[model samples]
Target: MKKINLIIATTLFSITFSIGAFAQTETKIGALIGYGTEIENIGIGANAEFPIMEKLTISPSFIYYLPKDESGIKINWFEVNANANYYFLDEENIDVYGIAGLNYSSIKVKYENSFGLGGDFSSSDGRIGLNLGAGANFNIGSSITPFAELKYVIIDGGQLVVAAGVKFNL
Candidate 1:
C-alpha cells in the first residue's frame, strides 16, 4: 500500500502543468446529478461557490440519493459536503481544480415483513469523513459555467461520486 501511494505521488509530481482557461472568481449557484458507485444509485444535488481569494474558492453542496428497495428492505442515502477548490491551470476555456473537504453522509435502512410472522426494523446512521477530488469548469459563456467533478468520500467504507452540472453566475 505504501509503495502504491509513493508511486502515485511521484507520478503527480512529475506531470507538467498545461495552460487551460481564463480564471474567474465570480460567485455561482448550480445543481447537479451524480452517481454513487457504492450505492449504485442516482442522486440530485445543489451547490454554490464563493470565491475567497484569487484562484481559490469555497463550495458547499448537498446530494440526496434516490431510495432503493429490494427484498422487503429499503435504503436511503444523502450527503452534505464542504470543499475548497484550487485552480491549477489557466490557458483556454476549461479550468481544472483540485478539491479537498469534509463530508457528512447519512444512510437509513428499513425492513418490513408483510406476513404476520415477522418483526420490522428501521435504523439510520450518519458519518463524517474526508473528501478528495478533482473538478473542471467549462467557461463557455459569461452567465453560466458547466462543470463536472469526481470525488471519493473516505469514511468507514469509501465511495466514489461522479457529478456534472451547470453553475449560474449570480
Candidate 2:
C-alpha cells in the first residue's frame, strides 16, 4: 500500500510540472514596413500575434500604402488581414513558419484635371483576397524578435509584398 501511494504521488507531480512548463501562451505586437510590386509603393503596418496552439499562431494586421499621384489623380490604399501561421521548425532561438490569410483591401481615388474646366471626382472600392507567405523569426535573448517575410497577394491584379519588422513579446 505505501509503495503504490508513492508511485501515484510521483506521477501526479510529474504530470503537473510538465503541463505547467509547456502551457504558456505567447503574445506579440509588431510594427512593419513593406513594399509592394503592383502599386509600386511603400507601406507601413502593425500586427499582433497570439498563440492558438503549440505550433499555430494567429495574427491580425493592418497596413496602409502611401498615397501616390499621377497626372492629377491621387490614389490611397489600405488593408486589414488575418493570418494563420504554422511553425514547422520551432527551435530555441529561431522559428521558421508559413502563413496564409484573408485580407480586405480598400482603395480611394481622387482626380482633378489640371485645366480650369474640370471638377472634382472621388471613388472608393474594396476587394477581398488571399495572402500566402513564409517568414523566419530570430530571437535575440530580449523580448524583441526580428523577422522578414515575403507574401503574394492575389486579387484583381497579383501583388508581391516584402516586409521586415520587429516583434515585442509580452
Candidate 3:
C-alpha cells in the first residue's frame, strides 16, 4: 500500500511539471483517479492523457485494490489499461466523450492459508471495449481546469464495469 501511494505521488509530480512546460502546445495532459468494479472487486485507477487530435486522445492507466475480505481471508489485484477517447461533443473547453479501446489486466489473489492455491496469479489479455462518458470543465480563474466524468467498460460475457473520477486539466 505504501509503495502504491508513493508511485502515484511520483507520477503526479512528473505530470505537474510536464504539463506546466507543455502548456503552450495543444497537448492535453492530466492525471485521473477513480474507482471501478470488476469480478466483485473494487478498484482504484490513475490515468494520463495525451491528445492526438482535437477530438481524440490516448490514455494510459493503472489500478490497484485495497485488501478485501472473502468469507474470512484477504485478497487483492492490480490492473492496467490503455484506451482512446473520442469526443462526441467538443465545444468550449468541455467535451462529452465516448471511448473504444483495449485493456490489459493483471489480477493478484492472496489467501489466508499459506498453502492455498493460485500462487501470485497474473492474467494479461486483450479486452475490446467501449465507454460512454461526459466531462465538463470548471472555468475558474486558472489555466488548469477541473473536470469530472463517468464511464462504463463493457467486458466480455456481459459483465459491466464502471468508473468515475475528478481530474485537473493541464
Candidate 4:
C-alpha cells in the first residue's frame, strides 16, 4: 500500500512540473542586422524562435548581404541557418543562451575583364558550415525583447559575425 502511494505522488509531481515548463515557453519573431568578415558587408536578416523544451529553442534564419564592390568585382553573399539554443539562465526578464547551428552559404561575383568582356559569374558551389555563438535576451515591458549575439562561422577562411535585433513575442 505504501509503495503504491509513493508512486502516485511521484507521478503527480512529474506531471505538474511538466505543465509548468510548458507554460513558460514562448515564441518570437525578429529581424537582425549582421556584419562579418567573409560577408564583406552588412547583412539584414530575419528569424523565428520556437521553444521546444523548458530550456531549449530552435531558430531558423535567412540573411542577405548588400553587394560589395571590391576593385572592379561585385560580390554578393547570403546565408540560411538553422540553430539550436540552450538557455543556461532563464529568467522572467533576462535570458542567456548558447548557440550552435548549421549554415548554408552562397556567394556570387560579377566583374568586367580587361578584354572588355562584361558578364556575370557565380560560384557553382555552395558551402555548408558550422556556427557557434552566445547571446542574451532582455525582455522589457510586455512584448519587446532586444538581443545581442556574437557568432563564429567556420567556413572558407572563417568569419566572425556580430548581430543585434529586437523580437516581438506572439
What are the models' TM-scores? 0.84, 0.83, 0.61, 0.79
Writing each residue's lDDT as its tens digit, candidate 4 over 43-105 gives 998876778878898777778898888877778777777788899997888899999998777
**Model 3 residue 130 lDDT?**
54
- Lowest lDDT block of 10, candidate 1: 14-23
- Tell me the lDDT of model 2 at 23: 52
lDDT, model 3, position 51: 66
For residues 1-170, could you state the per-residue lDDT of candidate 1 as single tens digits? 35434533543332211001112446777899999998899999888777777888878788989999989899998887878999998658999999999887888899998996779999988888999999999989588899999999999879999999999886
Best by TM-score: 1
Ranking by TM-score: 1, 2, 4, 3
Residue pairs with backbone overlap in model 3: none
Clashes of each: 4, 0, 0, 0
Better of 1 and 4 by lDDT: 1
Q: Is candidate 1 or candidate 3 better by lDDT?
A: 1
Record all residue pairs in model 2 with backbone atoms less than 3 Å apart, i.e. clashing. none
Q: How accurate is candidate 4 locally (lDDT)?
A: 0.78
Model 4: ten consecutive residues of lowest lDDT = 1-10
